[model samples]
Target: MARILAEISRTFGEYLLLPNLTDERCTPGNIDLSAPLVRHRVGELAPIRVATPLVSAIMGAVSSVELAIALAQAGGISFIHQNQPISEQAGMVAAVKRHKAGFRHNDVNIKPSATLDEADTLFKRTGSDVIVVTDDGNPSGTFLGLITTQDFNFIRHRRDEVVDSRMRTARELVTGAEGMSLAEANSLLWDSRQDVLPVVSADGRVTALVHRRDEALHHKFSNETVDAAKRFRVGAGVNTHDYLERIPALVEAGADVLCLDSSDGYSVWQQNVLAFVRKEYGDAVRIGAGNVVDGRGFRFLADAGADFVKVGIGGGSICITRDQKGIGRGQASALAEVVAERDAYAEETGMYVPLCSDGGIIHDSHMAIALAFGADFLMLGRYFARFDESPTNKVKLAGQVVKEYWGEGSSRARNVARYGQGKDLAFEEGVDGYVPYAGSLYDNVTVTLAKLRSTMISCGAISLRQFHDTARLVQVSQQTFVQNSEEVQRNERPTVA
Candidate 1:
C-alpha cells in the first residue's frame, strides 16, 4: 500500500511574511547574514561557515572558475560543476584557489616575438585590452614588456609587426617584488602614476599584476569568503560514479568543500557514497548530499553523515522532473517538513545538520522566506547563470540581452550521473533556456543582499539565527494573493490616458 501525506503541497508564492514590531537595534546595518555550512554539535561552531547565505548551484552553465572566484569575493561560495572530465573540474577548483585578492595571476600574455596579429587574437580570446610580453609566452615567464591597445592602432601598425616593437619594456616600467602586500603594491602603483604594476619574483619572472581599478573594487567586499591561507574559498561537485577518482583530485586541488550532485539523493547509492567518503576521509573533508524534498529524506541523509542536506526537488526554474516522472514536492511544503525534522533530530542526537534550500528561488524575497523556513543557506542556479561571470555565452534574444541557462538533466548538459539513470539519459528532466542578462555578480548580489537585509529588519531580526527564531509567516488564499498584486498594479497604473 502507498501512503500519502495529509498536508497540501504549497509553494513560496502562496506564503508571505508578517512584519514584526521593529526594535531600535533591528537596523539593516546590524543584520548578520552568516550561516553554518556544515553539521556540528549544538554548542559548537561548524567547521565551515559562509559570510553570506548564498551558494551558486552545481551546474555546467552556472558554476565555473570565473563565477566561483566572483562569488567568493562577494562572501559566498560556488560548487564548480562536475559535468566535465575530472581533471578539468579539478583545474577549475585549482584556479579559484590560486586567485589572490586585488592581483591577477592569470592575465593574458604573449611571447615578445609574437606578431601584433597574434596579440590581437589573444586579446579577443581573453577579453582583455592589455597583454604582457613574456620571454616564454606564459603568465609566469620572465618579465619582458607590457602592451596595451593604446600601444598600437590597427590602422597605424602593420599586422606582422612584433609585439616587442611597440611594447613598454620592463626597464621603462615600475615593478613590485613578489612578497609585497596588496596595500603596499597599491601605494607604489599610485605613487608611480601607473595603471598597472607587475609583481615579479627575485629572478625577474612575472608572478602577478596589480591593476589600479581592482584596488577600489576589492575594498567593496569586506566580507570575502576565504580559507585560513587567505585564498578564496571554493567547492566542487562530484557524481556517484566517479567519486573515487574525482574526490581525490578536487581535495588535492584545494577545494574547500564537496557536494554530491544528484537529482535524487535518498537512494542506496547516496548512502554508499556518504559511507565511502566517511571511511576514507574520516571527517577531514566536508561533503554535502542531496536534492531530497521531505523530512524522511532529510533524516536519511543526516543519519548518513552528510555535512549538510540539500532540500528541494522539481522546483528549479529549468527542471521538469515533476511533469516527466510525477515525483516532486512544492518548495514551501518541502522546507516546512524538512525543517521540523531537522529540529527534532538536533534535539535527539545533539548534532545540528544544516539545511540548504536548493532551488525555486525566483525572487530575492524568496531568500528571506527560505530563511524564515529555517534553511541555513540557499543554492541558486538560474539566479547565478544570468550573471556575466557564468560559463555560458550571452546572446541577443528577441532584441534583449540574455545569458544561456540550462539544467543538468537537459539534453544540452546530458548529465547522466547526476540523474543516475544509467550510462546515458533515458529522458530529459530539465530544459534549455535563457535568462535576462543581470550584469555583474557583485552589482546584482549587492541589491539582492540589500533587499534581504531590509526584509530581516522589517521582521525585527538582526541576524539569520534571530530571523529563523522570530519570523512569522501567513499563507495567503488565491484571492488574497491576487489582491496583494492588484494593489501595487492599481497604484502604478497610468492615470486616465
Candidate 2:
C-alpha cells in the first residue's frame, strides 16, 4: 500500500513520500515530522510523583511489585507482572504502599517515659498497629527504641521502670516502605543481623516494624498514571474492537490505564477503541493510545478521550516496523515531534496529557534522553526482560543469557493461544521460554536509577521534570555506540551466581 502511494506521488507530486522516507525523519506533505512539540512543568515545589506513573513492560513476567517498588519509588507504577491470581496482585499493591510511606508516625514512637498503660493508649487512640521505643524519636537525638506490652515483662522490674533501659532502639527495630524499593533498606537490616528494623521518617519517628517474613512476600503499585509526581497505569492492550469487549474485566482487576498496543496503533481499529473508551468509560479509567510518530495521531487520541498518549512507532527492541514493513522514524526524533504537538493540545485545552517514550531506550543514558525529548514517562522493554520477577524463567543460549521477547503487533501475537483473543488477551499462559537469570530486581533498579539520579544531579537538575528539559544529548556515531558498549562489557564485571 505504501508502495502504491509512493508511485502515485511519483506520477504527479512535486513533493514525494517514498524517497522522502529515506530522510528517516521525513514525512509526506510537509508534515514536518519535527513540527510537533511539548512543554512540561518542573519546579522546586512541583509534586514529585514518586509512586505512580509506571507500566509493567507486559512481557511473560507476571506483573508484580517485585518490579513495582522500584518503579513506585521513582513515581512509576508496575503491573502485577503475572496472571496467577488477582488476590496476589492486590497483596502486592498493599505491600507497595507500606514500603513507600515507611514510618509516617512520630508520636507513635515509644518514648522511655511512657509506661505500659501509655503504649496501650497510643495504640488505642491512633489505631496504630505498632509502637517503637525511643527517648524521643529524633534522628539526631540519642538512640532510643520500641516495645509493646508483650515486651513489658523483660523490662518490668517495676511499673516505674524507664522504657529506655530495656526498650529497643531504632536500630533494633524493623523497617519497610509502602511502594518504594526496599532492597537497600532490607540489606541494611540483614547486615545488622537484626530481626526487625523500625521504619522511620527523616525526622526519626517510628511508623511500622517489619519482620523478616515481611520481606519474603511480593510488593506492587497501582497499574495506572494520574499526573505529575504520580504515574502507574495498568490496562490490557486492545488491538481490535472485539478486544474492546474485555475492558471491564481489566478494569475490575485494578487496571486503570489502557494501552492500545500496535505498531499501526493509529489505525481505524484503534481509533474506534479510543472513541468508545472516551464516550463510555469517561474518567473512571485512563486510556493510552499510540505507537504514533506524529502529532496528528497524538491529537486524535487526546481528543478521543485518552488520558495519556503513548508515543513512538516501531521503536521496540524486538519490533521490525522499520524493517519488516519498511516504515519508521528514529525514536528520539519521533517522540520530540509528537510531544511538541501534544503539549500544544494540552495548553489549548487546559488539560495536560502525559506521554511515554514507548521504545528504543537501551541504557540509562537513553532513558535520560527519552525524558529530555519530552516523554513524561519512560516505557522500557529489553531492560526489564532479564528481571527475576519477569513472568518467565531464564535460559542459556550459546552461553549467553537471554529471554524470549516479541512484538505485540506480530502476526503470532494476533492469535495468541494463551491470553485468548482481543481484550481477552490481557495475558497469555506466557511464552514458555527461559531468560538468562539476572540475580535480583533490586540490583537492576539500584544500578540504573542511581545512574539516572547522578546524571540529574550533574545536570544541576533535581526533579524528573527538570531532568527532562535540561539534559544534554550528544549523538553517537555508530562507532561511538559500539565502543561504549564494549567498555561497558569490560567494566560491568558482575559476579556470576
lDDT of candidate model 2 versus the reference: 0.52
True-structure RMSD, every candidate: 2.8, 13.9
lDDT tens digits by residue: candidate 2, 98-129 = 44332222335556776656666665554344
| Poorest lDDT segment (10 consecutive residues) of candidate 2 | 11-20
Clashes of 2: 70
In angstroms, what RMSD does candidate 2 have relative to the true structure? 13.9
**Top-lDDT candidate index:** 1
- lDDT of candidate model 1 versus the reference: 0.90
| lDDT of every model, 2 decimals | 0.90, 0.52
Error of 2 at 191 (Å): 17
Off by over 4 Å in 2: 1-54, 61-75, 79-235, 409-436, 477-497
Q: What value does the lDDT take at residue 169 in candidate 2?
A: 57
